[model samples]
Target: MEPILSVEHLSVSFTRYRRGLSRAELSAIRDLSLTVEPGQVAAVAGESGSGKSLLAHAILHILPRNAKAGGSILYDGAPLTPDRAAALRGREISLIPQGITYLDPLLTVGAQLRRGRTDPDTRSRCRKVLERYGLGAETEGLYPFQLSGGMARRVLIAAAVLDSPRLIVADEPTPGLDVKSARRVLGHFRELAEQGAGVLFITHDLKLALSVADKLVVLREGRTVDELPAADFRRGQGLTHPYTRALWQAMPEHRLW
Candidate 1:
């Protein structure tokens, strides 16, 4: 099957002004390549400052003004240019951002999820998706401030899946949730992948990635050090890179030094 999303040798950097008028390029993502196949949850697992969130922003064409990105991103077999990304973002592609601030503080959940659609069908789907995520219909009337961390996280997931996007880019989506809530969010990602959406699950948690991802791309210092099946990572079977092995041994469930 063709991959729903393919990122090839993606590099991201920022222009910084040192002393005087001199400028320098600070590379954030040196070299990265990964693919999200339809019906697959491909996890990009790394430590903080490993360029995980930068990868997500690069894919979405939402990098900051001073940032520069190179390499190719293909979505559904075509180049994902800025205009193309903007066009398909909320329709064929979606993002579950790392922060609740992505939600509009002023808009009710229902209004944000609707995305300007006044049709009954859209409204019905929105309510159903909220319910699917264990949220009541009344939750839609609440503002972002009114939600707990877990509820806000679930609301983010509901919003992402509202359009039945073909590709979902989730960046550090489970940071503040409890273990059970995190597991539920992971289960939701698995379910979405099972329903034929490609999921790019970006996080610093290798254990959480192993729980839900089919393929694991281990990143360190903005580079992809190892890419393998999650089963291999689980049993410490085929991790060749020193960093990969270190990450494996560092897992709380596998503390054998």
Candidate 2:
């Protein structure tokens, strides 16, 4: 099957300037290449500042204008240019950022879902999406401040999938939720993939990734270090890469009883 999204030899760099000094270029992602097939979840796992978020921003064309980007990103066999990229975001490729702060505090949850170019069937779809994530349609009338952490997270996810994009990017999607809620969210992701939507999950939670991801791509210090299938992870097969081994050791299951 053709890749739904592909990144080839992609590199992203930022320029930092100190007072009265020449700017220094720092690369956030280095020669990173990956593909997301239809109906699969590709989990990108790493420590903080490993450039996972930068990779996502680059793919979405939301990187800083001053930042230099190299190589190519293709979606549905077409090169992603700024104009076309903007059109694809939320319509073809949707993202749920690391935190639930993207929602407007003043807007009602129902209003935010409607803002996603939803049609007259908006109410029904929003309710269904919310319900799938363990929320009710009645919660839609409440403001962001009125909802609990898990509820807010579900609302943001609902907004991302409101239009049913072909690809979904979720960053730290299960943070701050109980294990049951986290499993519910991951189960929803599985359903999304079954419906033919490719998912790119960026997380530090190895256990969650092991349970939900079809494949794992481990990153360290802005570079791709290891790519492994979920089956290998479940069997406790030792990772060949040191960075991947460290990540495995850092999983909650390895730390807790």
Candidate 3:
């Protein structure tokens, strides 16, 4: 099957002025590529500055003003231009942001979830979706300020999934939760993939990601070092890159840290 999302030979760089007005370009992502197929969970893993989040923004066409992009991002076999990304974003493609700050303090949870839709059915669906995330009906009235960190994150997840998007870009989504909660959140991502939606799960936590990812894209220094099945990391087999093997060995479960 054609991938629901394909990022090929993608690079992102920032234009900056150095001393004496000399221009300098800081490349944050270099020839990075990955794909997410329908009914699959693909993970991008590396330390901070590996450009995982930038890849997500690139797909959404939300890169910063000073940033330049190269190569292609295709969705369903066609080039995903900025106009297309904008139109599809929030409807067919959703972002589960890494930070809870993405939530608006002024808007109540229900309003944020509705995203300006006031239809009776939308309201009903919003309530049901929140409930699915272990949030109650009363959560609808709570603002971002009123929610705990974990609760706020759950609210973000609930809101992002409201559209039943075909593609989900989740950036470091499980940071603040307990192990059980994090596992539960990853479980939901798997559930979404099982329902035929493609998921791109970006994180620095290799261990947490392996719990749900179908394929693992190992990144290092802004480039893809290895792309392997999740089972490779599980069995410590089929990983060709040294960094990839090191990461697997460093997992706490391996006690080689």
Candidate 4:
């Protein structure tokens, strides 16, 4: 099956000015590659500052102005250029950002989801998306300050998926949620993947990734260290990289002490 999202040999670097005239180039991501096919969830797992979020930003063409990206990113078999990314962003590409802080403090829930558009169809779609996430119609009338942590998280997801994009890039989306709510969110991602969407689930939690990801791409220090089926962790097999093995052995359920 053709992959919905393919990132090959991707590298990102930033140029920084030092002192009066000197400059330095810092590499944040190096030769990272991963793929997410239709009806699949591929997890990119790594600790903070391992360039996990940079991968998402690069794919969405939202990298910082000083950042430079190398290699190729393909979406649905075509090269994903800046113009293409800009065109598809928020329509055919969706991002479930890490925090509820991404929500607008000034806008009502409805306005935030509608993106300030008052069109009837758009409003209706926004409401339906919220409803699908178990949010009530009255949710639209409330401000962000009025929402609980879980509700704000749900709102972020509802807003991101309002258009039903072919690929979903979620960056540490379960942070701050209780286990039940986190599981519920992960279940929703699985459902989306089952409905023919490709999902790139990024996080630092190997346990969470194993719960729902079909494939796990272990990233360490901005590089692809291991790419294996989630079942490998389940079966205690097929993990060759020392880092990968260490991660497996260090799981709470596997710890001897």
Which candidate number has the best lDDT?
A: 4
**Candidate 2 on 1-257: residue-level lDDT in tens?**
89888888789888999789988889888878788889999998888998888888888988888889999999888898999989888787999877788899989999888875456687788888888778877888999999998889888888888788899988888888888888887888888899999999989767778789998988777778888887777665867887777766666666656
lDDT tens per residue, model 1, 20-136? 989998999998999889999999999899999999999999999999998899999999999999999878899999988889999999999998899999999998989877889
Off by over 4 Å in 2: 116-119, 249-257
lDDT of 1 at 173: 89
lDDT per model, in order? Answer: 0.90, 0.84, 0.90, 0.91
Q: Give the range where candidate 4 is weakest over 10 consecutive residues by summed lDDT.
A: 175-184
**122 Cα displacement, candidate 4 (Å):** 4.3
Tell me which residue pairs clash in candidate 3: none
Question: For residues 1-257, what per-residue lDDT tens digits would candidate 4 score against the true structure?
Answer: 99999999999999999999799999999989999999999999999999999999999999999999998999999999999999998888999888688888999999888876888999889888888777999999999999999899989988888877889999999887778778878998898899999999999998899999999999998899889999997777978889999999989898878
Give the alpha carbon lDDT tens digit for every residue of 15-126 in model 3: 9998899998999999898889999999999899889889989999999999999989999889999999999999999999888999999999998999899999999889
Query: What's the C-alpha lDDT at position 156 in model 3?
Result: 90
The clash count for each model shown is 0, 0, 0, 0
TM-score of each: 0.96, 0.90, 0.95, 0.93
Worst 10 residues of 2 by lDDT: 248-257
Candidate 3 residue runs with Cα over 4 Å from true position: 255-257
- Please report how far candidate 3 places residue 170 from its true position, in Å: 0.2
